[model samples]
Target chain A: MKTDSEIIITLSDVWKSFGTQTVLKGINLSVIDGKTTIIVGPSGQGKSLILKHILGLIKPDRGQVLFEGKDINAIQKKELNEIRTKIGVLFQNAALFDSMTVFDNVALPLREKTVASESEVREVVDEKLSLMDLRGSNDKYPAQLSGGMKKRVGLARALVLNPRIVFFDEPTTGLDVALSNEIYRFFFKTQEKLKYTAVIVSHDVPKIFKLADYVALISDGVIQDCLSPEDFQMSSNPIIKNFVEATMGTIYSSEAMEV
Target chain B: MLNFVEKLGAYVLYYVNEAGRMGIFLFFSLLNIIKPPYNKIASVLKQIYVIGSLSVFVIIFTGAFTGMVLGLQGYNTLTKFGAEGLLGSAVALSLIRELGPVLSALMVTGRAGSAICAEIGIMRISEQIDALECMAIDPYKFIMAPKFIAGIISMPLLTALFDVIGIFGGYAVGVGLLGGNAGAFFSSMQSDVEFIDVYMGFVKSVCFGLLIVWLCAAKGYYVHLERKGGFGAEGVSNVTTSAVVLTSVSILVMDYFITSMLI
Candidate 1:
């Protein structure tokens, strides 16, 4: 795990709402460089919203979203683009460009954002594709790829730019157990090779515990707890207890209600 | 009575809100067009395809039929005064001055305008627009500018083609098919129609094209958030429908004023 001095992202008292419904409330968190931080929460608890805010896709209704200790909201459009060039996002459904091929999808940001020569883009794309074990399927469209392959292709695209921060929104959703494990392994290997900060949002508790150095649990529009996985595992909070036990369909105590 | 008035009032408010949103989108699009990060080649080519090539056949077909009908009808009206030679001139004047540009604009509005809105609307709903923003790509420069340039370029060119085809159709019916002297028919058309008529039509087509593309793209992009609670395919469909209907009506309304001033 990386040290606190290398914190890459910080959200201080952030709040976001959609009309009458508040998605996130007073959320404060920090993501450290070269370590994976997993955000685990119940469904519809604003995990995706938080990820969107971090990516600067949506602004917070109030408070600051700082990347490398500078407020991102105040940056102009051109400056924002520079900041965005250094970050990669993996959406829950792997929002691959439907108009582009697998190779083109991975090459899009490189072609548009950077001044890389054509050969450079080809080499980088091929290298990322090989890293993701997607070398032979470069010509395939997103629709042609399997769910696991789509996730991997998404990861390849995210890593193509070699971003300082990589965000995964439900990386293992709708995948089989074996495929999900493969995704986690790819994630860990990718982090080790690249040494970038990874902020992952998932409900996969076992995998999250295995991969995450730090975990944040959100519930009812607020972050309930942010702790190390081992500390989180040993905590006496019934909410956390219900969540961990519910995954295995086991009750820790007769008195504890299901989440 | 009160319920009917309330419904009418709600409809008015809805349309007003949509117009406001569209106005904001156009403001941003215009700003982006004058600024840097251009993507000039892609923008110009997309406009050529979307506005120009796609609209050609529809304009030609509509123009040919309209001219033929005008020739046939004008011949009947002028025959009572032994003025059958004037049929070609009547068709040429009506088409070049008004019907050609207006009808072509309406046709392209239905075909290209609705499509622009639907495509952009679907992207907005699917978070493709958000994806572009995250990548630091301006949605306006990437999406709207090409459509805007295409709309302006395509409409005037299509209107010009419509005028030419409609006049040819009139020539076929009035001179070759109708047993009128080709020399007399053409002489009347040339003598009656001025370059000012063509210029006026071109101006109207340009204005109509801008309005249609701006209104459609703006409505689709902005309406996504408003429909977030119920956001889905249905929301996108509703916005697309509104974009088409609103653009069509606005084009016609603006056409009246532009024509009056030109005349």
Candidate 2:
């Protein structure tokens, strides 16, 4: 077994396709423990696809996805589930079950997977909700919450498991400035407190650069570069420079439209 | 014209392949049902609400009206033979043995079954189901099992409710409107109908319920990965409508075999 400080997730020359159109041409990257790796790219550059591959939601057509050096694609379904339990995901739309109350939504993963008593599940859920300052909203349904509140509840649900790895897919996509800042602060605090490795897929260049230790810039079905966020900023690559500069004008640009 | 024909042929071939994949998905779900990791109470409860409780009104309204119309028509035919008293037996027997369950299953398929397909389809499109898969929760256990069980349990119960309410509706039309004796109507129904008649309807309903849930969920789940073209809202809508229409047609087709066996 690798040490705790070693890379937890490694993707080697992974390829994915939808029909003849290749999305991830060949993605190679490693995510180390206790560090946040942000994947920034033009929209539809397969950033979300990479996140899905790590989660084992989709298997690569070629190459390997290694979690702690074991090939995820070759593992049995039950064992793969065991691997998945260690990772938490925050969807772009928050994706909370609209039919359920907030407490039940946050408690879903624990209640579904484990034999935890309702009281125990509630205790854990309440703790996470309180951490996100979402205490009183437990009785509310997802439809009742504003966009920021939904994201907070989504984060609380992701944290309820205390997963070893967490993925945030555009966590601040539609939030107001103040709420977005709050979400960013929550990310930093949660990472520091839990020391969990995070993979964030975002076009929010400033926030990602500020918060991520390692950043991978993908363009045209290939990872253009993967470097320390500081190093990425200092590089003269026109693709990276255009992306970083474009982030300042608008959160999304017309050029980044998925082909 | 050749290009158009080629595209049409390719589209039909694509759908045929999708149906094959959906068959494989159901086979796996059936396998999961017999194996371990059987905890699916939450999903079952959700399905009970979505498939059972939400479907009651439409079933009842349709059942009542279909019974009344059968009474009206059966009364007209029986009157020519001076067999007006056979109206209760005719309506109850047809409703309990065939129309009640079949009609209720059809209506519920249109209402709840379509919704289930659309909901799961949207989830697939949004990557929410994938999120669940990554969490190590078996999508079959977390999503499919509860719905399967709920469909099996609820469809028969709903049909039974339809049978009862439908008989009452026939009674209202025959005795209250057509001036037939209430006592005679009840006696005729009691004399003609057996527990086996009820049993046949319930059996058919259970099978149809399983088909609806399995086909709808399978279509939604498999359609996403199998989509050869670009994935979008159009793909979801196409699958959802096809699921509803296909399940409805299958219910009718299967109803024939079920009725023949029981007869």
Candidate 3:
């Protein structure tokens, strides 16, 4: 378990309900700084909801989301935006602008936020695109790219600002196994080189467990347990064990479980 | 019967809520319409080209036909009383005050408004707007304001073009085809049409512009939050239909009220 000093985000008794359907109730989570924390859970288990609250994209009906020691919900819009600049989000569909080329989509943040010259913006965009191994695809619009290429371009745009932390929403959901493995490897390599804190909400368990420093299991509007993947595999907690067993099959190799 | 009333009540409440939201959106858009540090100048000009310039051919086509019909109908009606000289004033007033602003606005609503709604709706569904918010960018100022400013600036100019072309179309039919005296046709229009009439037409066009853009933009922006299963293609279609229908109805309603007050 991470100590208090290392924690960068804390959700204190957060509850959110959409209409009469209660999605989250009394959810508490601690995300440590400079660590890859993977939120693993069943579909529709409020895993994505927790991510949005931490980013202040949505507010909880009750309780607080504290990011870097400040209550994000209570902060002013300007202050929230300043804090958001430190974070980047890779949406599930890549969300690349259909009208823009890959180069322009990646350059958008710099152009909008900073007064960087066109040449300067181009240099940064090129560096980030190359980092994502999307060099020659710059002139292509999103429609021309395959799913994996779109994800890479999306990752390139998210990292264009060199954010302090990055969030991924199901980075490997739709891709085939080989592409998924490649994405996982890319994420592993980039996060190592960039040293950005990572918070990923994904369902691809055995593979994702390989990248987790801390694995949190949330189910039924509450945190079931949070542990290192090895500990999660051995946990007696029924929800945690059930989630792992369901993903890895009952005859799982424990060697594949190590983080 | 009870279930039907319940559904009816829900529908009314839904429209009422939508109207309140649109009014507030227009209010904020107006407040920020001309505020500087206008970072989205390219976006604004793009919309101007789409909503204003690209629309010229359609406007010319609609204007000519409507004016031709007015000339033929007005000449026939006036000649019954041996007052065919009034055909010029009739055609001019009808084109400038009624068809110019109203038909142009309706055409724009069908052309540009549905496109705007669909585009923004797609942006919403695709999480592009959320991505903007995540990047510390204000989606409203970046997306909504530019379109509003462009539409407002575009409408009056298009209405003026519509009026000019429509009057020429009337001239072609009334004098050339029907053999009305050209001097009387041109002279009566100049004598009878006042400046206030043209000003009122311009005013209607401007108001109609604000209404169409506001309705289309607000419909698209709120599409994701719309509670009536506003998801996928069906949701966007609902928004587009509502935007186009409401724009036409509101333009006619406001035209009557504005003309009544002016007269």
Sliding window of 10 residues with minimal summed lDDT for model 1 chain A: A250-259
Consecutive 10-residue window with the lowest summed lDDT within model 3 chain A? A250-259
Which lDDT tens digits does candidate 1 get at residues B77-164? 8888899978768888899888987899889888987788777777777677777777777889878887887888888989889989
Which model scores highest in TM-score? 3
Worst 10 residues of 2 chain A by lDDT: A250-259
Every model's DockQ: 0.61, 0.56, 0.86
Clashes of each: 0, 0, 0
Ranking by DockQ: 3, 1, 2
Clashing residue pairs in candidate 3, if any?
none
**Which of the two candidates, 1 or 3, achieves a greater TM-score against the reference?**
3
Q: What is the Cα-based TM-score of model 3?
A: 0.95
Ranking by lDDT: 3, 2, 1
Over B81-124, each residue of candidate 3 has an lDDT whose tens digit, in order, gives: 99889878999999888889999999999999999899989888
For model 3, the stretches where C-alpha displacement exceeds 4 angstroms are A252-259, B1-13
Q: Score every model by TM-score.
A: 0.91, 0.90, 0.95
lDDT of 2 by residue, B212-246 (tens): 99888887886665444325788778888888999
Predicted complex 2: CAPRI docking category = medium
